[model samples]
Target: MGMRVKQLSQLRNRIVVITGATSGIGAVTAAKLAEAGAVPIITGRSASKLAAMRGRVSGRCGFYELDVTDNADVQRVVDRIATDFGRIDVLVNNAGFGLFERFEDAPLEHFAKMMDTNYMGTVRCAKAVLPYMKSQGNGHIVNIASMAGKLSTAKASGYAATKHAVLGLTNALRAELAPDGIAVSAVNPGPIDTPFLETADPGGGYAASVKGYLLKPAQVADTIVRVIAKRTPEVDLPLSAGIGIRLYGLAPRFADKTLGKLLNRK
Candidate 1:
């Protein structure tokens, strides 16, 4: 009897900020949130893309050119949003990327860039917005992680590290912010066909082997909007992927052996 789909429409008037909203899952999610009646304030690195996306979403959607990794830029935007909207009911930390290469062959700069944007970006945004969300005594933060966060995969060590960091942050924040009526969650999806994986080289056979299981960016967006409106602590887009994570989490060595087998088939 708790708030179901019919009652979730109460979020229509909420001010929600979505990062990385120019393209990929973030953009699609921005549009969907508009449809669901939330005032979606979308952000990305490019002002042009944000403007274009603002024109595309359905409801009261705005755009902010945000570089999430930069602390000053993040604080500037968070302050701006609080000043303009008075409150941010939701913050979606979906701005992140990854490169693919063997750890030995990979350039240190690329890995550094990944951690800065993926891990530091989430941390900066959460810190910047915590006071606002805390003062309001109610808020939700949804971090778009990946199945990679829960398992080891070839050529994704850098990506996995960032995502794992995010998951850790989400869990810790959830515990710390519980009494404040704030909710923190990590949404982990498997193989969503987004620009996150459009690196120069994947350097892994696993990705190439299973091209069909990939979901679209819009699909991931659908699940994310659901997370925003509901108080779900954790959501795995595909139920099967959740089961797989548990299986691998239970026996990492066995999972790695199976991964080798799967890759050999490639």
Candidate 2:
């Protein structure tokens, strides 16, 4: 019992920076980390929402208006956080959007937007923080990717592509920063019950397809907390989905045929 308390105490007061913290997974994660006694620095595009989020979370909280897609803004905000906090203990790259549409039918601009916001945004944040983390010689970077990164669906071409890039970046950075004592991990979650669907599938087609199987944002947040506390390498939410994705990797064509049928069901 004493050891458990000690373990929990170790997590207290660590500075954690979270992107896309205005809503969805980012908001939930920030609140949970704060509850665990961590000092959370939350960033998003909306000032009002940022204020409200800061109010909702317990402990010392910092809120910044940031659009992750802006490289200069990301760098400046991250630098300021490092300066204020003395060191950034953890960085959660959770700022991203999804666009669902058939590749042939999707607009080129949509693909560009996803790439910039999801992939490049993560890159920018990581680049900005790497120096501080490397100098400190210890830090954790948690990239919030998705199951679509490992396995793509019909209308999720653009979204999947961006997530795939995130996975790639996470994996590569994990190795690149290892010698510097920095850990990079990826959290690949399946569909979660969030406002993402409103933008990802405006028509509600994909949401309808995944009905009853959606994960809660709190569940993902719990996993993320564990990732930061334990320095877990990679986490795939809903273990079943992770297993299925692995199995699919073993037999691509057959698995795709079988899974496609299941996902296409009405």
lDDT of each: 0.82, 0.89
Candidate 1 Cα lDDT to native: 0.82
Which runs in model 1 stand beyond 4 Å of their true positions?
1-4, 200-208, 263-266
Top candidate (lDDT)? 2
Please provide, for model 2 over 1-266, each residue's C-alpha lDDT reduced to its tens digit, 9 standing for 90 to 100: 77645655667999999999889999999998888899989999999998788678988988888989888899899988887888898999999999778789989999999999999999999999988988899999999999899988777888899999999999999999999999999999999889988998788877787888899999999899888888898999889999988998899889877777775432
Q: Per-residue lDDT for 222 in model 1?
A: 80
Candidate 1 lDDT over 73-175, as tens digits, reads 9999989988888799999999988776668877888889999999899999989888998899999988988877876566777888888888988899999
Query: Candidate 2: lDDT over CA atoms?
Result: 0.89
